[model samples]
Target: MIALDSIIGTLNLDDEQKFITYLQKKNKRKDAKNIDLFKLLSKSTLDSKAICNQLYQTKNSNAYHALRKRLFQSLIDFTANKNLEDENSIDMQIIKYILASRTFLIQKNYQVAYKILDKAEYLADENLLYPILNEIYHTKIQYAPNYPKINLEDLIRKQKENQNKHQLEDQLNIVYAKLKTVLNSISHESKIINFEIELNDILKSTDIELNESLSFKSLYQILAIANISALVTNRYYEIESFVLKSYEILKRKKETNKQLYYQIYISYIIANTLFRNKKFTSSLNYLKEMEDLMLLKKGVYFKEFILKKTLVEALNHNYTDNQDKAISLAETILKKKHNDIESLLDLHLSLLMFYFQKGQLLKAKSVLSKFYHTDQWYIEKASIDWVIKKNVAEILLYIELESDALLISRLRSFKRSYSNYLKQIGQTRILKFLNLAEKIYKNHNYLTSKTFKTDVEEAFERNTANKEDIFVISFYAWLKQKINKGDLYKTTLKLIQKQ
Candidate 1:
């Protein structure tokens, strides 16, 4: 039941309509209830038992379960057909060519078979479709003995090269999987581990080179690994040059239409990396390029990357003193059904931060309430780092509301769960911030005391030579405003400017 709802929820309005139309064509009986079940699941409002009651109007679990199975199968068929029709058009063309060439080969039409295979091989080579190319090469080699024009040795050599590329892609996929596992471990495990070293070791095992003649998809994976590593380790500044250089190289290549998806994603990674490094203008510039690229192919990839592009833009605006713009942008995304759960959580948290900085406690709390998922759910969907940030923000919001009971409970839960992990990561400043907040909760007078102010200063002593992450500074400014009794928004801006 949950799986059905998840699939239904991912479809947009046009897709929903297309699925309905498809069902209309495929349903064999007027009494078929798969469409009804689909509609109920699409709304995502009721439990399976309730849905069964509504659909059957009786205790008929057998009929209800069978209907669900039918509806689920329909969804799978519809999505698979749509993907081949839309996203895999080039692959379909290549497949058709291969099939047509095989038919000719079987008929002993060697001249026409070679010509058809030539077309297939050309299309595959243009797109670096290595697997398809291998198939085409194998077909040629099988007929090499009968065809005097066939270069059997050259065909074998090309087949070997294609196999190597495919193997490299497989190796990179393993590295990507390893990276995700390590990141999840960092989020969930209490054991101390240097994520940067782990990432480097996994990447080194791949022995992949930036300048390797890899497919665009493989290159995108490489950039994604670097971006995720930088994100987790706060090494955006270190990877900024590498990401930018890779994008530049990609742009210089005469990429085919098939490579546009990877190209757009690579640009997004570059934009996000720049944003992390506080190069707001440059980040926005890259975003503009990404947006233009998204316009290609009638905006097929636009919806795919809209959340990410908007999130980066909003973050840049928020840090640039355009919180209203940021809030407006973020609010627009929340009204739609998006499968990008991680980005949705990020947008919600950003909205919470924006409203919190404006001292709009009610609005901040409203945004915070949208995070209704469990900690385990968030950990699985988002990350442990995001969960920690959300927890801290909730504590601060409760404190500002003077909801002592809720604040105390939340503070205790956060400390119990993350204190040692934070200490392991050398983030004692966050622990100190919570401590000061707790002190203020106990004795409001201490919030403005000189001794408390000095403690805050000492706890968050800034290294003037190194710029702080804008988000770190934002959290620190909240504590500063509590002591100075100043505008939270202004204090945040001041700290950002100083950085």
Candidate 2:
């Protein structure tokens, strides 16, 4: 529904204007009866405005009946044109049938619009081989399925065919084949967490069987999800081979749907890479373009778009207006439903940073409860969260340590719980004791007595995160050492880096 439906492909400014003029001259957008099938998809937002109010209210309504008539008539037109000697002229006419219906979708008759596509697909399937069919299959399947959509056996057969043929040169085909898998995976009522996992592994694996039942460009678009997911985990390096393979194939394309869709996918991948690598400003810019492009029907699935949008929102929001809808959806699915706790940790941590930036201490504290002592993560989440905890504590310490009235008032204004987990768990545990030590140190009551100094050193010694994540544990230890009282800080950093 976005305006300025993308002027896709390699169309120069003049050519872009020419296309826009052609649409205007055709009077296509205004033609409720004519229906322009030439422009349904152009890597631009299919501004539903063209048919937005054109829906037929009754079966006998003039526009409704006209649509029904066109559906059958277009079929005949495509059939007759397909049998013609020359291919060029015939192709445009059949393509027109597809675009007309695309406009009709905005007419609010999803079924009629889908029905036309079904007829087109049937005619096209009869007329063209699969590579082209794959182009429309995912989109059509979303609107309506020609066959039983969830033919798992059929999909499995296709996957096997692809597996047998998988190779680096066949990378494009392989990706589309996987896309068919992606479509099938989500078509069912419940979310298929394992399917996503499989999808991700396929992207990260070096031993790909480049078996493709579809075109190369489609494959790139399909694999974009896996690549983006990997990017979030700082594992973009794992997907580099697949990403390069996808990009090369896309670069060779002559700007068809596959190419356009691939551009959207790769651009998002690039934006995500930028985000993960901490190029925040560049990531923001690229993701804005990617989000716009995706709105133009660039990505597949509500899940993919929502997840990516969440990432974009997290990076861009300043005033708490955006809930990072994508991230929220990801958290709701991946955390609450899929049990992807590691992912939840990352998503929650980002939101925590969000709340922290807003100085919404109460909300930050609420979120921190979920993050503080998770058992699931053995990787980035645990390490990063632990580090964040220390950073916040140090902030508290610094503000309180000045022992001044203004800073004390400012600290109190934060009004967030600084972890009663310490009180519950007792002072023997590092998190608890450090909680008290930070409070005391800020009051300047620490280092006041030999007993207090002993307490501080004891807490500092225990500050070492010995269980796992040596980079984190060791970093904390390093700080302790620099402060002149840490016991294992140096040794811990050494061991963790070895990991």
Candidate 3:
């Protein structure tokens, strides 16, 4: 059986109440302890042993395990029945139509069966649900002899075409999985790898194209791959045209709500990409579009995308010289419990930057303290890139705080931990940055020298395209602030504006 407590933990207050009522109606015995077991599990504070003792007046592993099994089965049933009851779910509606069609066919009602199949087929086709359409086509061909007007050859041809589409979808699914693996594995690495080229090579091998003929799901997967690539390689500018084109095709498709999840996510990708590429105003405009889409179906996906929406909004606002607004947005989200651990970590680090730039050293140090988890925990939960950013930020904060010993300690720890990884990822600039930061911490006079400023500028690449990643610029702003004796926020904005 599934982990009973894990599933229980996912239920909200209303879901828990509905589940309790469901159990009440289904309970055959007044002595049944399944509801009590569920309630204890939902609380998630008691262990299995403690729960068993309370339920059985002793340590009864067998009884507790049996009750847990029953609860898991009930959750399975309730969730399945809930899906069937969701009128907004097109997949469930198609399944209902297909099952009804099958029932009518078994009852020898050929006219009704054909009508139901047609409805199922229309819905499936509109949603690009090729697998379901294949099943519907199979049922139709099986009963084709009962209806003289049924086009047998046409049905077979359609099935073949659908099989091709489904095969392509399966290929894209593998590509999506591969992209996710690469993203999770190499997010910490620098520009040593040409991830976009590697992904393009894979797509070329499969002959996949971002075109109108591809289904909504396929386009979404392709866009998702591009988004991951952009995130990995920091090349959001390169994928803007392709993402926009795929979005246009997504809009032209029928039954948009059927793929609402994809639509919402694709909009997020666009907005985030625009933000990364320094198109702040356009990014906010698309964020508005994304919010409108989130309001559909009674805001089913609002909670899911809230962190992402807020993150992008804050980043835009932060870069646009609205540091107070950015900090407020991030702080508001941080107060809530969100599953987006990565985003939360990001917000914490962003808050550090915001407060640091505003010359609020104490607040910046407070934000730094919130990163209480170990480096390994952060690397697993977020990314090594994030941990690196956090470490660099902490070192900078310590420097500003004039904690010489702590600054030296953090500088040494950072180098000892990431020096090899930086070399492995061809990020020698970061190592050089650590050296410069250490030098400044040791003397404090070298940071303002013309020679040190030239060395700093030479250490980092001045991209001809002048479109450095925002986080990269954020980290460099500390150095720039020292070099020019200027405002941190102004230095960051000037650096980006120079690009």
Winning model by lDDT: 1
Q: Model 3 segments beyond 4 Å from truth?
A: 1-5, 24-58, 86-88, 188-197
In the range 30-59, model 1's lDDT, one tens digit per residue, is 988888888888875888889889988987
Query: Which ranges of candidate 1 are over 4 A from the true structure?
Result: 151-154, 188-191, 464-467
Question: Against the unseen true structure, what C-alpha lDDT does each candidate score?
Answer: 0.84, 0.45, 0.83
Tell me the tens digit of each residue's lDDT in model 2 across 358-476.
44556655665664442223223334233334344434434423535744543443223323422332322435344443455455544445666566456554443323322233334
Q: Which order, best to worst by lDDT?
A: 1, 3, 2
Write candidate 3's Cα lDDT for 276-323 as tens digits: 888889999999999998988788788778988998999899999888
TM-score of each: 0.94, 0.34, 0.89
* Model 1 lDDT, full chain set: 0.84
For model 2, the stretches where C-alpha displacement exceeds 4 angstroms are 1-245, 248-252, 259-266, 297-304, 316-348, 368-499
Q: Quote model 1's TM-score.
A: 0.94
Model 2 TM-score on a 0 to 1 scale? 0.34
| Model 2, CA-based lDDT | 0.45
